[model samples]
Target chain A: MCLAVPGKIISIDATDPLMRTGKVNFGGIVKEINLAYVPEAEVGNYVIVHVGFAISIVDEDEANRVFEYLREMDELAELEDETSS
Target chain B: MARQITIEPVTRAEGHGKVTIFLDDDGYVRDAQFHVTQIRGFEKFCEGRPFYEMPSLMARICGICPVSHLVASAKACDQLMAVQIPETAEYLRRVMNLAQLIQSHALSFFHLASPDFLLGLDSDPATRNIFGLMQSHPNIARDGIMLRKFGQQIIELLGGKRIHPGWIVPGGVSEPLSVDKRDTILAMLPEAMAAIQRTLDWFKRTFDQYPEEIRTFANFPSLFMGLTNDKGELVHYEGRLRFVDATGKIVADQIEAEDYQKYIGEAVEPYSFLKFPYYKPMGYPEGIYRVGPLARLNLINFVGTPLADAEWAEFRELGRGAVLSSFHYHCARLIEILNGIERIEHILNKSDILDKNVRAYADPNRLEGVGISEAPRGTLIHHYRINEDGIITYANLIIATGHNNLAMNRGVLQVAKHFVKGDQLQEGMLNRVEAVIRAYDPCLSCSTHAVGQMPLHVELVNRDGRVVDELTR
Candidate 1:
């Protein structure tokens, strides 16, 4: 079964990566997740959590770049609408 | 003395399962059984609940591929309401379903199965896992994470959350796709495309390395079943039922979802909680067939997308008939992911994707309804009988994993016979047995509607039922 959720890490509770635990915000809700699988994840970083473990850290830049592209597309659509009108 | 080998709570799969192998005195495997150990009784508990709540309720069956349950359950409720869903709603549902497939398949291939592929099946058990994969091949692992994220992000954009999103409802979706969400999903497509293509190339190159595995991992003649469009192209969200034999000949086609029970029969086994679904005409056990990626690829004529179609062309060449080996299920998953990405992009570009007319409101007109769709694993059928008050009286779910029960059992025996030896229990031999089951990528939780962890323990017992040896992980 492939159920996992992306959450932003709010705080780290442990120092050792293998024993690392953190509170992650899933949209508005937050829960403590194990960060052993994502050693590089830190406070303010987004991680993909599955069954209580952080499986991977999300690439914030890559995510933002997609939104930036979407914004540009919105601008282009507006220009096309204005020209047609 | 004759002995029995039991592998309990099979690891790396979605839910609790175990394998029991009976070995003759000399240590040769005589027979094997794949057992589903947990049961949730979702159907029984669903009674007395409002029919409209079925989608969200059914979505709780499994965390993985909840969208498939949502789609199938919603479709059943639509039939109960007797209203045709809007075109945009259907397209939106299709996009979400495909997104589910991509994410689920990625989890199967990358997180669960890749470690076995990258680190040889005989590799160190302690290191043979996703973490091991991340340490050894970070790039491949990253691609898998990204690909899965791409799917989850789309789902979150559309359904409002990554798992069990309640956006899909009876008759239609809760909301229409917004311009920003549509464009955002489109923007993510290029990266997802590259990730799948790269993984596909790597898998194709690595495929030939496992000749022996290809020959024995559920490599036998049986029927393959899945959903197909009118043109016989690949379809996942919605389509007519199709069954093809091992030789790739159409045994049954265009079967209505409502008529599924007439063609398929559910048989119970004393050994497992999962039901054995077989072709009705052929009868129980003998009507053995497989569903999921392998069966889907076998049943379809083409994948529809350019990149996936090219890979599918090569996949079909693996077998003269229906590609009997279950080992290739991994390869089939990669191609499907590619197809899902392309299909999602195509659906988003449709003019009506952002249309406001997406929901169809209607009261219950039908007391009995059947909904069928292709889940990430295989064909998922949700049937319900409701009262005049719109309360469900009965519900039956024949999950994709349940359909492959017989094949998975036979596959376990096949792998066991080939690799398992007398009293001595080698880790590799047992790993192969589990590998064969993993090839099916079964969600035992989905099949039985059960809940549990993925932990495995195996035991070897002598004829007197005495425990001779054991392995636990």
Candidate 2:
């Protein structure tokens, strides 16, 4: 079983030059998220997304760590190659 | 206690839900659970509010279908207020409902369901979504986007802002449908209709390709529920509840919207926050029934609109008496798109559609009220009890998805039992489960808005209670 939840942001737009927004991939669906709420956020960040709105920001390391843990347990079915045969 | 899996904060719809597929000792499917993850205390919240305030307050329920809630809540309030709204108001309300129908059906089909259909079930997960759809079918995606925009534009012209427009009040709308706006909306109708027609033609001609998808995808038998006028016409607003069996025979007729409690009963489960509503007469589990587009199409013989009628005939020919497959819900919605165009055309021709006599002010002297209307998904009912001081004492909201709870669960289990096999998880099998939810288009934010997000943790344990692995995303 795999899950999707909200995480906080350690930094905003850590990788992107776009300061107003950055990229966050939820289960591999990367969407450019707005940094209106947490202007202080930088690279390696997380946030709860709903209908294109970022309800809250999450931690990047925590989110990656969760994915790693899920990957170890085989609960997180890597969607990276879901389309690829 | 058993093998478990969880997808927290499921997306592509209004709110949130999780699907849990249970496996038996022999690796056979046990039961599949689709749990609605959110719960709002709206009913309890309305307990102490005034009757007239319902239309506006209930409008806040779901940003997607607030009009449905507003219409239902206002109708119920009208019943208590005992004031007859003008005929012109009724016509305007119908126009609003049709506008909502056009946009909402467009969103569900083009934005949500079409990705699954056009992308191919087994396609790459990353590319199988809306982004991929944009790349592949740019025109088709554009049609959906434009069509939905038109619908929202209609609502904005008639109500106010796109979502949760506060135009429809108890007696009538807060204002009249302007002639200039009507004319402008009418101007775009032809292009919109053409776009919809193009997509419809494509789907109809290529129907054969989706045989496997149409046949076994949520194609289980269940009862149909919807609203019908006294003349037994397709009634979206102010009508009685009608239930029909799989054989297309009326199981119950003339069931008043106010007395829905007499026939519907809600069942609770330990795993999910959303309640499973069942047919009170048949009881839980066995009383499972379907609502929404699939159910609505099953209940109606024809949509009456010319283009829609043509598509409806094809839909019936494809699925027969009732299309049980959730995949066909997308098809049904397209048909409604045609129907909405025809309905809009008829309304536009009527002079009363833009009459200034829209609002009918009524004294809020009643202690209790009920509002009921056929939401695009299914029947939506809002019941409120207010004290003499004009404060609410009790409230009950029967949303479109809530009405189809039993049927949704049944569809999920049916798909799980049929497609899910062994320990191996297949994308096709998972899509089937998601397809079932798509059929109802359940709005979790509308259903429940108060609860904080809960973490979904699923574990598959062996006989010795050893956790071989844990998956958390």
Q: Global lDDT for candidate 2? A: 0.66
Worst 10 residues of 1 chain B by lDDT: B445-454
Docking level of model 2: incorrect
DockQ, all candidates in order: 0.05, 0.04
Residue by residue across B1-473, what tens digits does model 1's lDDT show?
11233332321223466677777777777777887764434466578889998887566434446789999999999999999999999999999999889987887788778888898888866567665777789889889878877877888899884345789999899999999999999999999999999998888999778998889888999999999988899998778999999999999999998999999999988987688999999998899999998899999888888988988888888999889999999999999999999999899998878999989999999999999999989999999999999999999999898999999999988887887677767778777877888888776432111111133455665665666666554
Interface Cα RMSD for candidate 2? 13.8
Q: What value does DockQ give for candidate 2?
A: 0.04
